[model samples]
Target: RMSTISSAINLPTIYALSTPPGQRSAIALIRVTGTQSKYIYHKLTGKEKNPVPRKAMYRNLYMPGSNILLDSTIVLYFKAPHSFTGEDIIELHCHGGRAVTSAILNSIQALNDMENGIDIRYAGPGEFSRRSFQNDKFDLTELESINQLIDSETELQRRCALSSFNGENKVMFQNWRQTLIENMAPLTAIVDFGEEIEIEGMESILNNIKRDVLKLKKEVQSFIERIEKSSILQNGIRISLLGKPNAGKSSLINSLTNNDVSIVSSIPGTTRDSIDAPIDINGYKVIITDTAGLREQSDDIIENLGIERAIEKSKRSDICLFVLEADSSMKIDESLNKLLLSKELQDKKVILVVNKEDLIINKDELRTMIHNLNNEMKNQYPILPISCLNQCGISDLIDLLTKEFKELSDTSDGADPIIMSQRVKDILINDVIFGLNSFIDCLDSDIDIVLATENLNLAIEGIGKITGQVVGIEEVLDVVFANFCVGK
Candidate 1:
């Protein structure tokens, strides 16, 4: 049903540059797809015969009306049902130059204006991918995976996206859907022939449905947990450095990024705002934020405002590095300790960092102080003694962070595909889970078979939304494809 609607609305030939738009590269690829794709190819190449399907041929392109030579290009043709969009397709590979690529695109537009009976237009963002979905080339999850693959920044993200694009999620969804249908079949049979079914067989079928639902519920819960954990990998892990003035917060940021991302000064409250520096940590993207130092008694309005911002950043961060001076006579600030114990930071992971370790006269005394502080707070947060000035213990800090990140991102034990989109989760929870619960309740209460089957159908439709099998909502496709590039 959706395929027919898509085909009806998308009847014209569409074209766009499939490669990044720039002049630095050696070549650029332009893709065309539609029923009239062969016509457009012939007009551009001035060849009566189309190039062999799936074969590249060298040809000279020309302007449609004046027959003016444009450029010598390599062209490939694909017949319907075999191309990316499952339509007649043509690809032109031309030299990557500001003038050459622009001239080729402009010529195609000019031909569209002069031609009759066939329409050709530039593709919109994700339009190529949308067409592929419409033609049943790939499901919605696979489409999202392709977009993720393109936008991937880290090795783990790339591998996960590639796994989804290769039909990992599709296979999982199919198995779930089949199990659901098998369970629904017995309920449907009971509804159609209520009295004709044997009592023992009915009891067996009901038991089977209950067992399958329990198993599926467990699997769905596990998938949700995996998604939550893998989210740190999908969106880079955020670590915020927070402490009182002159605690080496800025210095630590500079050391991690190896650049002057944050200004380091001995003056209190030198940093008035949060500065974010993104760095690659062992194939994972980690964003470290250097925030304004916390202070209890600040007469300066700007300093107080900076402290407020620092607290807010700490609340949102995945990990908070609470820095302290190893040589200072004062203990941790009472106000800062209270803030760390507040409800806003309940979920945040805290790590104690004692800076300027080289300045400490006694190592055993420093360790004793840290241990006592941990006991006083009633939390055994990992403490690392470091000297930012001497670059001591920086490697140890990195190793600790890497270990934490690996624990959060590990997915070796599960066979279920990762769910990347929050929209998918919303649908599963609000629609699929709700419908499943309704059906299960109906069965447990010995409700009408018709009502139970109706709820079961609703559950299946909800699951179908994930794969674009039953497209009740057009907005779902719009949202999914909106993130893709124009040529995808």
Candidate 2:
């Protein structure tokens, strides 16, 4: 990915390892892109074979200096404006080996200052996508979809990325954004209708404006829901565990993580703070937290602070988990239940987890008790039965978490475009709400329809940037240089 960024420089010829390094295979590709590609092919092969664009040619490679045979390769060619880089591109399918690939690259660079004056350089991270963006090969949304596909952790995420890559989301948004522009026409005309104007379709335009406004609002609602789903899938959701002291929170954490990351002694206050670790469950990142037991009695100031932090984490969490020991069998431990059932945690997404299930005499009786206890809550919570020790019901817990993420992501199949970065979100909100909405606000003014169109274009550009649609070539170059590592 980093290699793509480096190609934004003003180099004429670009080349890179089309396949990743450190691999042995039947074949590997050495790809080159530039106007001078044909010259190199001619110089080495001693044939003006031109290798018709988009055609594959079987050819023997030879080092001009020694007339020594290099290897047999299928020379693939793509003519300008039709290729991946929108330039004359050459690709060699040669044997996969470090020495062979290196030799080929060195040979390509050797004829640098020759007839074509092409400076053969390696591609930067993300430069291929960047170049494609430059040539309108793929829109900003498609670029992000590719990125997401590479980053997908879960089945659902992979599905969304594939869907977006296939342009399921981009087509939806483009159709909508374009429709919004068209719909705005009559709305502005409706607002312009006055006694002096006496427009013929005044009534019709006003009705259309109202109808379109409602439609636009519905689109916004749909977009927000989609964004919410994409966010969870891309970033992974945060689930926090909170309860009174010795609620088996640490034990559950250890079980879920399959490791003793937290202190789990019989001591009531063994874990004095929030302990968090990332674990991949069902291809989704779950940052599970084992927080200090929320309670009032604490002599140590740090422990008290930890308790406060636990409560805060619960409030900030995507899912709140309230754990209880199965042996502490009361339907409601009036003291702690009152505190938990208090206004703050109520109505939040809380899961009632019954830990220490291995110690229970009868599974049915324990389930009934936990169910009955949960029935008294202001809101219904999921009753999950698990035993951290002996690893009982851990798979069930993981299943529960996967289902939760699937619900959060609303993921179907590959290809869902997401506003994954805050930079994108900010660009969108600032342009749409402030810029486009403000344009609507100016309908009654003397501003011309052309000015409204201008605003629409601005909104489009901002949206384009969000999806990597119409990225500034210079911006791509700047970022590449800024993030450049030594020996890049």
Candidate 3:
């Protein structure tokens, strides 16, 4: 299938707007690649000869067979065998106006209509990256790294993706494959022949293979654990706001997100459901959920349901913001007190947020109240005072959240390597774990040597899937490349 895809790259030239499609930017990038790139470059530029490879040339593009000027652009050409796709490539750096981009694209497509012109078509999503993979410019893992780097929303995501893109993960996987192949050699020899081959240290070889497999399994499991821990960086951290009615939870949500995503109202029980607003805090993605405030009892069915959802969301959140109105005379409500003491929220990072601080003149009373609550709760939860009306202390709140987020999402250590691709991680978790465990089981029991060899083969193939070392990888390639944007 790979060879088939590689051979199909010979004829039609593919082009697309490599940059985002919009007029917001000052410039746009158009990429063309395949066998007819040189011809297309010369024809569009009205030059008898193609420009020097890797050199930029200023040219006025024109519709094929017509003198209609398309745009004044900076063009570049890359000769085959050394280009991104291992084929002739052309780049048109044109104005970002929609009309200009559309006109140039239409003119490029017109090349297919010429009497002796080569085939030209728009590039599909990830087609450029796929071509790079097919041409040996990159492997599946590196291609995945490129996609992750493009989609990354946090610093950790970028660092991990860049590390993998630089071949750190590839080198690690290659070493594992080599180890598997080395161990499999002795086992394969015993399995191939029905009769026991007279070999020295047969028992010793089997024992040594078990030790190696055990060590490899431990390493793989450790990596899996690290992947699981760091996955929160990819998926935003969840935060739930819990407090009494009209305690300014909604206001805090709006201030945190800098958008009025939740309705703010003075009347009690205004929020009847959980409202989610995803925000980026210091490059850390966070999902802040504004839940219906907790009360001792609610007659309204909808309000009751909202309160229930608040509890459920709080239980699942990584952080819980327990808002309290600083000016209000009422103490913590019965339901809120019950929730604070509940085992479900005990393990979560609960911060006592004193809102409406702008209404208070003296800080001593508020401090006494916080001190009392801390003594009663015995949790010593971090307390932050903020006034959403004035946006006071919001930055400090954000900073605190960012600090906690760093600790929660930290995957850095000198020993463990990071795998950013979910595809690769899934392959490791589902396929590699199964093979390794099965092989170990076979070795531990009085199972057949042939069966143990087959299990080892399964493990090898699973690792091969990560770096594209196995066969029948067309489906894997499709999934990996699907994450990319058009012309990437």
RMSD of each: 5.5, 7.6, 5.2
Worst 10-residue lDDT window, candidate 2: 260-269
Model 1 residue 344 lDDT score: 67
**Residue 46, model 2: Cα distance from true site in angstroms:** 7.1
Q: Mind giving the per-residue lDDT tens digits that candidate 3 earns over 1-488? A: 33235574545789999898866678999999988887788778888875898888889998777788988999988888789888888999998978889888888887774356567899988998878777778877888888888877666567778888988878888888889899999888877655456767778999999899889989989888878777887776888776656777777877976732322221233233335534567666677654433332222322244456556778778998878778646455555566666788877888878898888877887678767666666456788888999998888888788678766766334332264677878889877888889898988898578888888888898888888877887776788778689989
lDDT of residue 369 for candidate 3: 72
CA lDDT, every model vs. true structure: 0.74, 0.63, 0.76
CA shift at 384, candidate 3, in angstroms?
Answer: 2.3
lDDT of model 3 at position 66: 74
Judged by lDDT, which candidate is best?
A: 3
Tell me the RMSD of model 3 versus the true structure: 5.2
Whole-model lDDT, candidate 1?
Answer: 0.74
| Global Cα lDDT for candidate 2 | 0.63
Better TM-score candidate (2, 3): 3
Which residue pairs of candidate 1 clash?
Answer: none
